[model samples]
Target: MIRAASRRGIRCVFVQGEDVMEQLKELIRYEPGINLEPVPCRCSECNGELRKVEEGEEAILQDKSYVPMAKIGKCDFWVCKTCGRVYWQGSHWRNMRLQLQRLTKSYH
Candidate 1:
């Protein structure tokens, strides 16, 4: 799932495959004045931090306006130090969340 991408001065690996597989391969444009930040989280494969991406910059979409958010996954999935892959909620996350809710239900 490690796709090639660069952020700031750090060369990062992004997760590949899934809904928008092609999007993962797309590189984000860095603006000279933009302030980017690295997404701190565990990689789906190896639980590593995703490479830092310059904030304030936008990803140019074909036949559309600039994409403000990094559509890595649902929420933000960071890359891992080992596997160098990104991870986040795919499609079954809602079911997982519901299970958690059920488990954490309080006594009425």
Candidate 2:
């Protein structure tokens, strides 16, 4: 399949693994410049650009239910410009950053 894609002038990085981290590592091995570090720059749902929800701009979210009231003043919030999906750095973000840090150490 990779050969077929290459014949059509396509670039590909083959990765196969059950573990998500392993697969990501494999991808990074082939594409060294790819940034695996977690950053709230794009929407996970639609790949839309994310803009930080500035102070006094939380009302633009439209759906208030998605906003975590407790984390409002605790962390920065971002909203997808296209899909309006809200994002915040919670526990998962820390875990992902840790994994990426480990992956980065292996490269160094």
Candidate 3:
């Protein structure tokens, strides 16, 4: 055990983890649910405002010269106008949206 004396003449005792539970339990409080705010459509990387990709900028979405042949799909996309980062509802982003839905529903 380590011992130390304070200037106020109080004996401060260091208690091990096993001996401190009873004294600490009353000060803890638990809440049953969490509160969440509305999800904003911003850049996941930089949180910058996202703008729709404009005409003639399709090259920014993918490397046209190197991209392999792919099946067709349509998804609404938003890109960060500042950093030029693209955002699309891939599986991970969709999963995060689902989690947000579950949390808001659970809290309500």
Candidate 4:
């Protein structure tokens, strides 16, 4: 589905004056679903349970500003409690989503 969106060039744009970091943070917030559960620092990719290393750390966004709130980074990917596989916000997220949006728009 994501790849399909990319082929059609569908893109997501933030509202005017909406900071990308804030938007990204909102997207990164947790939502409950069958495959996901709010758990302690656990690596999403490796499935290795994580231990809290820090309460939160600041993240720098592409717009050259820090995210308003502290974000957690995992030492390893799989079980990093801060983020799981289903939803991850990183440097590449925007670019990757833009391409994928095109692929997704085909159905729309």
lDDT of 1 at 77: 38
- Tens-place lDDT per residue, model 2, 1-108, is 789879999898888977879888888888877877677897989988999999888676545786777788778889899988899899989998998888888886
The residue pairs in collision within model 3 are none
Q: What is the Cα-based TM-score of model 3? A: 0.47
Q: Of the candidates numbered 2 and 3, which has the greater lDDT value?
A: 2
Best-to-worst TM-score order:
2, 3, 1, 4
What are the models' TM-scores? 0.34, 0.68, 0.47, 0.25
lDDT of 2 at 57: 84
TM-score of 1: 0.34
Preferred candidate (lDDT higher): 1 or 3: 3
Question: Model 4 over residues 1-108: C-alpha lDDT tens digits?
Answer: 445656789543333337653443433332111122233344646655565333333222212233322333533122244442223354465565664444334323
Per-residue CA lDDT of model 3 for 22-45, tens digit only, reads: 222211212224222323367768
Tell me the alpha-carbon RMSD of every candidate. Answer: 15.8, 4.7, 14.8, 15.1
Name the best candidate (by lDDT).
Answer: 2
Estimate candidate 4's alpha-carbon lDDT, on a 0 to 1 scale.
0.38
Model 3 collision count: 0
Model 3: runs farther than 4 Å from truth? 1-40, 54-57, 64-73
After superposition, candidate 4 runs with Cα above 4 Å error: 1-45, 48-79, 82-88
C-alpha lDDT values of all predictions: 0.38, 0.84, 0.50, 0.38
| Candidate 2 global TM-score | 0.68
- What's the C-alpha lDDT at position 28 in model 3? 22
